[model samples]
Target: MSPAQAMERSYATLKQMLREGAFAPGTRLEAIRLADELGVSMTPVRDVLHRLAGERLVEANSREGFHVPRFTEAMLRDLYEWNSALLIMAARTKRPGEEEKPIAPLWEVPAGADRIAALFARIAAAAPNHEIGDAIAAANDRLHPFRIVEQRILERVEGELEQLITRGSDQPHAIRRYHLRRMRAVPDLLRERGEA
Candidate 1:
């Protein structure tokens, strides 16, 4: 395989392991072992490890090599705070008046709401029996993609809003208002999901 393909495969495997709790926080990831398991060369595995380190998913230890980053309660709280803010921003950009709508129904199934619900259920069930750090890490793994998608949507909306504002259009404000409503509902959704 090409170096890029190898790197991608290695990263994917590592990421899966992290998400599944196969590699718990602070667990050292040996390059040779990972390469052998993934059927890739050390070069690609090393590159993937470096990339993961940059993303804060893995930490580079001078003496022990790369290990999964450990999470603190404060760190988890901060992550949730950031995630909530970003979701609000994204929702606001999509349809500004979404806040006025009752948030409870917004989290109903056949939508991203179900995914959130499932994630929280997983977290809740795991939290009591497992380490808090592990639960938080798993939650982060699940929530990260949703945040990424939200950011992408927010970026697109911002681009359009910019152009509309330049044209002195009133539609941008209305759109933003709707999005704010939707964004405001996010916390409620999270709460519901967490409780489920």
Candidate 2:
């Protein structure tokens, strides 16, 4: 593979592992070990680490190497609030060029985290601002692991989403409830993973 390809592969693998809670917070992510684990060169590992560091997914110290952030319950609530606001913003903002589709009846599909994500993505994409969508996506990257880790939360909120789509009630209220499900679910999940 080319150097860029190697970097991309390593970056994606590391990101997946992080989301899955494969590494605990404060665990040292060494370049050589990770390169070997991902079947890539140390160069790609370093490059990916730099990118993750930029995203605040990992912290780099000159002496201590990269560390995962200790994501606390309060921080999780803050993210939930930020995410809820984003959904509200998206629901409120009118997309300039795109004609708004009536909200999809998402309940027809089998419910899961991915399905919930697609639902939220539809809400987010309606926003006229590309920057808002991008911010939502960036937050999603940090938040995806929680979705995977606790699929039940998404499953639990399926009815709220259906109501949002079917009744066409206020969009932000339903979206806030959806975000709150994760906010409520994270504490137990973090404790289960011993990351709390």
Candidate 3:
């Protein structure tokens, strides 16, 4: 394969490993060993590693090369908070009479619902093994629509959330808490529908 293809493949492999917890957080990626394992040259592996570092999926250390980025509990909480705000923004934008309505309720009515249900089924069927890890990795790859919906919502409420965050508004914590509660309900919902 070409260097570019090699790099892309290596990057994808590393991403999957990270998502599946194979490359656990804080574990350094040994370039030569990784290259050998992936059957790619070190150059392409280096390129992919550098790219992941830039994306904050990996961290660069002068002494030890690159490692998966680690998140503290507080950092994880903040990430969830930010995500909750974004999700709310998305749901609101998709709601009727919302500005422009990037995602029409009608679109999510039939096909979207089916698609989401299928995803839930897959999630439910994932076993606690390598197969489950693969499924989770694949699920991350298929999150574009969900991410787009989130981005659309965030775009609308960006200014407000930014202002609040900048002004040290405590509302994000509350919003975050609300989202956590709602997220907890998801598993139950899926179970009720016999999807889980």
TM-score per candidate, in order? 0.52, 0.82, 0.52
CA shift of 121, model 2, Å: 2.2
> Residues 63-148, candidate 2, lDDT per residue (tens digit)?
88898877788987788789889878887784655334655555555665556666767777778888888878767767766666
Q: Enumerate residue pairs that collide in model 2.
A: none
Steric overlap count per candidate: 16, 0, 1
lDDT (tens digit, per residue) of candidate 1 on 14-54? 87665544664567899999899999889999988898787
Which ranges in model 2 have alpha carbons more than 4 Å from their true place?
96-111, 152-155, 164-169
How does residue 29 of candidate 3 score in lDDT? 91
Residue 196 lDDT in model 1?
A: 13
Off by over 4 Å in 1: 95-114, 117-196
TM-score of 1: 0.52
Better of 1 and 2 by TM-score: 2
What Cα-based lDDT does every candidate model obtain?
Answer: 0.52, 0.74, 0.50
**Which lDDT value does model 1 have at 60?**
97
Overall local distance difference test of candidate 3: 0.50
